[model samples]
Target: MRNGGCCPKLDPLPGEEESAVRTSHWRKELERRRDSVERETDGSNMKTATRKKDGEKEVRAMAPLAPQLCSRLAQKAMMRSSVTKSMASRDRVRFNVGGQLFETTSTTLANAGRDSMLGALLDDSWNPGQPEYFLDRNPACFSVLLDLLRTGALHIPANVPQKLLYREALYYGLLDHVRNAKWGPFDGNRLRLADSVPGRAPGDGTAIRAAPDGGCCVAHGSVVHVYNWMLEERRPISLDYQQVNDVGYIDADSIVITARERLGRAEGGMAVFSAATGELQHRFRVEHGQQPKSFTAGALSLAGPDDNRIFSSCKGRLNEYGIGMWDLNTGQQGDFFYELPGCSLGDADILQWLPSKNCLMVATLFPRTDNCFIGLLDFRAKTIPWSWSDAGIVVTLEDKRVLHAIAMEDGHSICVINQYEDLGFIDLRAGTGTNSAGTGVRWSSRSKLMNRKVPFEESCYPKLATHNGQLFSCMNDSISVFSGSEHVLTSTLSRSYGGSICDFSIGGDRLFALHNEDNVFDVWETSPSPII
Candidate 1:
């Protein structure tokens, strides 16, 4: 212990040695407890990780089943809806019209159309849970309408008046159906004379225009007599003793009339009138030098049903002589085409608008002018794209002067007829230049080939019309029908009583021919072709 002699080393006390041993043992026990706690935590973390992995696997396995379940649910719902609709459509309905009981299916009433009165009964909110509907309407007409809805055919008993039937149809909103059933479709070959209406005035009708709805208006002097589809005379339009130059239907309810200018008036001629009430709705005015001036409108030409433009040849005391355009709805002037150098548009006897080419055909024929002038006017370019005239052409004895001209349906040529019953064709695509002077017309001897003799009476100026690929021409008392590409003579329509048709119009599945002898008019209708 005292080897170095610097300091002496002493042995530890007994109690201190024992306390150090106990402290060492307690330190080892605390380290052991800390190791045990770490092990337990690691075990708990492993369990949590395994549980999370199991949950992820379960979710991935169940994902495909969801869409299948939704698809099954949707299919069930659609099947249920379809079954319900089928049941509802087959539901029975009862109607008591004017104390007469009638029964039908919901499907039949649905055919009456939703806008019709009968169709209103099919609505679920309309008197729900009601056993029967009571309508305060005529039972006889109801029976006819019901049969029409069920069988798709209309048959009127002799006891029921036609006007009464039509009035009832209007109430039920079935007038269109009735009109279709009455007159099927227009066929010149299958036409049959349905009726002959006597004229109201003493003079021959100047014009006969067919209405959109199977009706017509006959213009005689200053009076225009309108007749409905039932051949019932409606209110006649009076022009205050002014001569009617041209008349046309603006719609089923309104008509545009062009009359000669008054003696002292400056601007009051063209007017629109209510077809039903004969009330004047509008008066068209012509302007020259930025001022409204008096002018006489002649030869009205309406641009198709969808177009809103009304074109007429206007003539005035001043230099306002040309084709005037007006708004059909507003009755205001839209544009004025001044007369060209050699073209007299103001005195054109025929003005026809060609929708396909966006041009208007102006024809100043033989009677209107010494020489016949036919021109195709392009409004957008303000130029005559194609024109033809007999001014310089030599006329032989066989060649007749063109009296009336109508553009063909194909829009490639124009068909013209003369007093001598000759049909001539003018090619629209013949020359590269606008002037068609030296280009001769292709004349057809179809009328002469048929060997038809002219009547002894004053030969009426033959009129030309084309409908549904068929060409129609009237000579004396007969209308010759031409068909096919070559326009071969197909048939002729004539009747004994009506002598020499003055004017004829075709529209709404009907043809109206006005006779010049007794101011009588004939109504021709075609039977509906059997549906295969």
Candidate 2:
């Protein structure tokens, strides 16, 4: 064969030429297959690139809607979470108390105050999944207290004992609620007779002092009977027949008792005792000539709530007659106001500390002496700036003897009451430069309008007290309440059972009146306002 191309080609034998042609055909076939595969691959690659570019374009086109979708999903999640919390907060709670079931809301439990046991249930630890709470308590009392939490009113069933209810109330921290619902805040004009306790001995209650915790102590001869707010006697303070002169509360837990000096032993004086235990805490001693002298303490007076000084009238054998001040915290003597010539400090029946004027009012009322003497002693200056006495004043039919006196809250005047139910006022501003004997008292006959139908066998001296800008006076078997700026007689409180009222004390939003006949004492409390 001739080679027509520019390059020369070599000829082969017949069989070899056939074989070579088959080989050439096989190689061309393989090349053609490779080229076809490469074309298919290129087509596939181009299609894949186009699909990727389309996916990217689609992603770019949807970019603005992505944030809106995410925000909508977030809002939906927040709404679900808030709904869950709201449902949890509004979920009802059940309490299985003493096998009794109680159902209440979280808001109702919250009204019990966070410090209370029921209110504590609203805390986070209280699982909302919890179906019921169990409390092993008196169910009846629990029911009453739960009602109190619901309605802010306490109603005890007839079967439930008051003491048992009180115990439950204390356990639930609802005693204040119960007390408020029962007695309410003290209003002198809206007083009601709550209870009466008979004395240990008839006509033996010498003095009745009120406690800060709505308790009281009655001095019966040498023994002092202390009663709590529930009228339950705690302990009797006895002085071993030494005769208790006066008793006052240094605080809610402590009581200072003044007893007459023993005849020869010189042991009876002023001692502070525990109101609950009746144990002696400390003894107040008077020192004269640098030696502890045996003395007798009289009326007790506290400086003020912020002050720690206690003042007591002291009398001794030598010359220890004066007002002795002692540090109530340390029981050490602070200072002594020696008895002045015209002012009888030792025999003062009433000693009141005036914080506004920074002075002490010492009054030696009648029956203790032939005349009455009321003097304001400034301890800093050691001078009687103002005083009033009925010494030289002529006694007339219209002038009644001043039995009891109390300084007004304003510190401008002193209120005095007589046995004939006459109210008098002594102006402190008018008698600035005058002597105690020359200070005149203005008497008012407004209280005399309330007349008694019949006279009693025993005469009860009237007492005067100023509280919440109102005046309280107890005469005979009744107590008169005076109100307004002029102190007009507005209301009268009288009881039929107890005889003539001997003494009355106003404290802790309650009034305690001690009667003379049966040694009975009456409790008066103000009613709460109606809930709207």
Candidate 3:
């Protein structure tokens, strides 16, 4: 044998023909062994090839992911989605909130919508390399928000402060979801009657008014009593020989009371009294003629730029009704008092007086009929600009139920409620055509109030009053408080009065409810929740 370069090259020695024969025999044996080895490793090689193909298939299958799929699942569960330990680090997210650690699917965080902080963080266009989020907020509160996002529901803890939770919700842009959670009826704990005062007379309270200076006036039987916010008696006027219809404040220190003499000379009149002292400041006698009238029809309202002029709806002659104006300072009557074209006022109630527009809202009921009329008396135009009767509104709706309406603070919209608990709005500004035939008034589609319970006939007649951009209505024993531009019920107060409410008034952030049975007056202070 001899070596040629690095490989060994066999050289035939002695006999060339014999060496060639031996080399051929060795080549044949080498081929046989090679074939045996290939056969032995066939199964192992096949498995290796199959595994490589499977790995490539998996990579192809996972190349694309749905943007919000992870979040949707977590939301449905009302909690964070759990990932396996074998999941890639990029698919999972860890959060450190106030020293608390939370593990969730990255897709779940992205489901908060692109506008939210979590969504922004998960957005690859903005946060390309983010793997974990650390929030400087209450972890417990964040958990609640997470559950809300996951479950489309909200569960607040007993120990948590709602204001603080609301703040967090706003910070995270979850206020809409949180506000929707509070959309149902109001809780009983929202509005609470804080004080009660027994009436001086044994008669039931007919009317109540909240004064400008945080005091209240109540008319029970033939007596009017004034009380401060603390329900302490300040003044009491015993009008045993008179029939009082309504009481209101002319100024912080003075109040105007409307009453009719019930004794020998049956005449209706308005008297001014000092709220500080129970002394009568002035008395303006009403002269409607002596015709032995069955019932009196008039409502007292103060107008003018300084709210010094008084406007009254009075029946001038038999079966004739008109609006009367009087100067409170000078006690002088206006030159002209306009009367509605063909309507007669039986029991007139002055709803509101807009000094800026110089308009007065009045609700009139016919003497012995189910007809109710609401009109706007524009002092600037010196006419009853617009009016609507129950019959006029009934033609517009399918359900012809008994309806009670109130003038909204906007001076254009009227809030109406019917016996069937249907709540709707009438647009006074949308009044079209001439006032000759009373053609124009638009009604909104009906909806229910905050009360989920079915309304009864007794509670159906909910009395509505507004204060500080909020509306208060006394329905049965509960007083509902609605506030905001949309007028959603923030809460309700349950009255402790033993009887049904005869009258209720909201003034100076105070709510007054009068019991129909024992003449007990319950007063509640408005504490509205913050708008979300």
Candidate 4:
């Protein structure tokens, strides 16, 4: 009758005597054979005939089985949340104190061996006798509430009784859900964590950049959270929710995003989400404890005709494992691409995909062996041989002819890449690269400090992009355009992105979008006549 390691909200731990008494309650479980034999022969009677025997052999009889012992052990392992149903009156009733709405009945399923502290609010007052939906029978409410607490959003069936009450479905994952099924326009904005004076998001007016097509993405949390920047009526509309570590535009409407979520108890790691709706379209979760900390998801290159045949880079734990393929259509491994005998992907490994040629480029990070190298893999080939990187941060110019890579002294660094507006001369077919060591295409930041020591351009790694033949990059609160090196600063200004920017996409029209990798982003465009 002691707490016996029960939930914190329940009875406390037992006294010394109770603890010691329970500790000695171990009993060897009935082996499968013995249990089977007992099932086959219930009574102690065994028939004996012939052999001059009076004929009756007694088998070992089962003792009066302690019923309370099995129940107690089961109680120790089973957990209860705020929503547990008790059979009140003749009808069975379910309870959910978390929602604060007693219903006719409900059923939830929680995972085993985990604790649900926030769900401890349910009690016995829930009753079904009055026709009020008090308690049904659900064990999963704990996980639902835990998810809400963690991500500030919860995905539930729309028909649930309390679904209407959820004007705000908050869950973890750095994204917010503003449910306005009522008549009103609702847009998903990135959740900003910096200073927000009450409901006013940080530099929201200054932040909030639109993508190339002219629409904005919701930004939130320590990391970047962009709803799939798909468009509607030339406006940015979220297709789904996606939390990605990094992203690259594969084509006009599709961009590959790397996403990961970490839940306690060995369930965590990276996945790939879609850029259209911000939804986790596909993911291969590597068990946190099962694999090495440095195991790669084989992102060195992604190629396919927009189907599910995806490949991953993995380590077998000892040395270089090999290249593995994933059949996205079925989420299974389709093929083993190749193997690097002693090579492996390090922390800053870079993977690039060139769709036109159906090839992939990979850069491996090893301390003293080789610099960044590029490799090409063909889905049609029998072997996937890796070509080392001459440099990291490889990118294509607007003209689609030239490729650019950042060159430094050491070999492990990957400078951020961004597309600056077409500010260079229209006379030149592509933009240019200028850094500390000219252009080695095989260098890194050996002794440079990222913040206080690295050069402005070296650390910032400015991108070059063109819109309407005008080259532009967001610099110091103004979108600066360049004609050759001659610059023209847009007098119109947006709020400052604290750090140098790296990523942006055309949200809609002339509305340019910009983000500082870690902070909230802002959208800017020249204004027409002030509309009423």
Candidate 5:
């Protein structure tokens, strides 16, 4: 076209000949610009150089620019840098973990939420340093935690102990991670079932009594089996009765028992047995001058080691309901050994004996009401010096709360268990004798909602037992130990061999557990460890 002549007649070379020159010239220009940009952005102060076509090095001085032009260029460069940083923050996060570098996507960590340590560190609202996070933790353990965050699963190495891994997971609030990894109880490693012994009878284990002579007495049906420390069968005493309420050792070989008549053939009474000879030493009728009484529904507790007297709760005509006494040698029963002062206690039972204080701790249920009472018998005064009723515990806690109680080592305080599986202490030393409005004694709650894994209605009544100044509570299949001084829970033994516990006792430096399985019992002792 003639237009090219007017513009000075530039002509295209034929085919590849023209393309070759154009490509070579443009490649040189691109290389020059690239080298200049690299020099500006490389963050180095040294002057750069270029090579000429003759292969000789040519020094290039970066020319100083006008102040306004340089300022505009700097602003554009800063905007680009900020945009790059924003994109990186949205896509991923970087961490300097214990000097070890790590990176992951933002969404991966957000799944655990900001409450977790990792999420808190990555939170943009509070943390302006989004590109890099630093954590002072074991890199090896941190790697495991990060993997859990990314994959929603914890894959711990074989060399890492689970306990150590658990500790790290807890620190990161990743306990739920491990919990989701495992099912059932999380305390399998904390407690162990040491030993279990089969029950000696058919109907669930009723009671386990540890004798003073290192022997254990297990009661079922009408017989009590005594076992030496080695689980060897000592003489088994078979009582001539239908039901045996309770049994305890009066001496190394002699034991006392409370029972009822089988079909009303014989008088239901308290009897003594000789473990060494399997002989019926004596039997005292649980009656008041020919008025047949029943002790089968009640409990028994020894008066004193040498007093040769035992206390029992006897049921008879409404007028004869009271606590009875038995003289081991005289074979005599006291009708009104100690009755409720003004009114007849609906139902009373001796729960424990405080030899040091010469007092008997008793539990009574008020008639026609859900109210219950815990009384302390001052043997010297022959009356109840202090008593606590359900109304007195807590007005809001008036729903048959207390089921059983045990005198603490102090003798002035009693540890009680409620129907709700809660443990509390009642101070008997502060109460006035009358306590008309249920304000005589004071109750302080401790270890509430224990046995949370098993509800009270689904399990047997939790039992309380104390030994060596330590308060032990048999809740469900486990035993909770509390410091007698502060009433704070110190330890929990939740391992049950196989069945639900019906009763338990602590004595003879051993813990005896009676499960619902017929004739099944377990023994536990603290394994020695360094005091420090």
Candidate 6:
């Protein structure tokens, strides 16, 4: 008898494809945007001649150009579908945001604190005109676009293979899109992120900076070793692999694995790997120490400007003191941004970073305090250079087994209000005090989407992973995957080859972990054993 086991992704029945088809709606808006830019630029050029008055200098607009041609060379922008007396009957583009409908030829969105890794997907296509143009796009996609527009380069997470993303960008000529804004897929009606992303070494390896998995620092006398519970079986087949002063966790196939120990340095520090198999990619340590005079550096941000990249306040006084920047492409330490005047050393954690405002939103609970303060740390100015403003409430992940990811503001903090846990969303944008929140995620539509709230603990084994559409989590030895009410689970190997299951971290659709008696790390797929 095949003993069944549960894992973290959805395995649709027999031959049924278990992946989520919930693609972000892109075509309709792309059509509207393309039409608008063309018309606006072309019309404006035409109007420039008409709008010019008697006294005004000849303010000639840019010369007109065709849509596809203009897109390739930037002669003009795509025309928007709009109207004048000649086109009064033309229908306008409609946008639905957070359930509100608006009649705007185009939409604009503010992506202050969205995930930058996701932003990287939008980076290839440049010169997209403006952020408002993609307003009707998915919030996550829009946020990334807004981030790139504001910061020039979008931040990629360390876990994603830079090569894979680069390949996707290169394939779609994302660079052209970024440069012209006119670059669309073959359809010519949608803003396309690449069609074929290179498969992950272990498939679907996204950034884990925000996974429920947190690093466990074990002190062997003076030296501190970083370890994570590999619930499944992973490489290096050890109870807990040592981080070796390596402040971040790269993807399963780390481009470079540096096992170096930098004493006290930030810029120009070198990292050395014993095995060179996949070793240290770059060099740069974060500044450490404390207030007053100055502080020496040590740690680095786990991910990047995005919340996934974070500061490892693991050193003395400065351990949790300042912020460190970890590059996703390369595991090198980029730069360090420390906190000032504020008491975030231990209590505060970066929930997310608002690239638009250059602000760091942290979730911290200070002493002499009953509530946790989700403060916004702005590093835009000089001098002490940091300001603190409170986000309505505090949130945290209570699971000891599962890894934790927290994003403060917009609506979520530690969780994305999905089928997994008591994760709730407070829509601050609605102006409703802190009380208004969304319950279980839109799991499926067959029923009410959400019926009753089970205790958060019961949601364990709650295989959690999100790709283009579905949100997944596991329960016990079973893996449950869901998208609205349309979801399923696959039970394969069940009977425990026992030992306290260390952990379960998912990337691409693969889960990595090490069990009790196994010295080898195991990789499990959402489906059976094949990569779809």
- TM-score, every prediction: 0.78, 0.81, 0.55, 0.35, 0.56, 0.35
lDDT of 4 by residue, 190-267 (tens): 112212111122322212334333334443322333332222222232223323234433333444434333323322
Comparison by lDDT, 2 against 5, better one: 2
Per-residue C-alpha lDDT of model 1 across residues 34-100, encoded as one tens digit per residue: 9999999999999999999999999899998989989999999999998887676448778899999
Find the candidate with the highest TM-score and give its number: 2
Candidate closest to the true structure, highest lDDT: 1
lDDT of 4 at 104: 27
lDDT of 5 at 338: 40
Model 2 C-alpha lDDT per residue in residues 13-120, reported as the tens digit of each score = 669978888999999999999999999999999999999999999999999899999999999999999999769755788989999999989888888888989888
Reference-based lDDT, residue 340, model 1: 94
- Candidate order by lDDT, decreasing, is 1, 2, 5, 3, 4, 6
Which residue pairs collide in model 1, if any?
Answer: 266-294
Error of 4 at 517 (Å): 9.5
* Candidates' C-alpha lDDT: 0.86, 0.85, 0.65, 0.36, 0.67, 0.34
User: Arrange candidates by TM-score, highest first: which order?
Assistant: 2, 1, 5, 3, 4, 6
Local accuracy of candidate 5 as per-residue lDDT tens digits, 1-532: 5665586666666687778989999999999999999978664433232224223322222234456678999999999999998777666778888899998877778876778876775555745445687878777887888887776655678987666776777788876665454322212123345467786577766678876544588988888888865566777877754578778878777778777645545456677888766688887676566765554435787776667777777665445566676677777875355465553342564367787667777775433235667777765567776677755444554453666778887777777776556776666666544356264334444434332433534566778877667777776677777774776677877553556677887655567788774458876654322225
Q: Write the per-residue lDDT of candidate 3 for residues 366-460, one digit (tens) a residue.
A: 32345567777676576777676665444543444434557777776777655444455667767532333233334333333333554444432
Model 1: runs farther than 4 Å from truth?
A: 1-90, 97-100, 128-138, 392-399, 432-439
Segments in model 5 whose C-alpha atoms lie over 4 Å from true places: 1-194, 286-297, 341-346, 365-369, 379-382, 391-400, 433-457, 528-532
Q: Cα lDDT for residue 8, model 2?
A: 67
Inter-residue clash pairs, candidate 2: none
Selected candidate, larger TM-score, 1 vs 6: 1
Over the stretch 178-245, how does candidate 6's per-residue lDDT look in tens digits?
Answer: 32231211111121222111111221121222122322221121122223322211222111222332
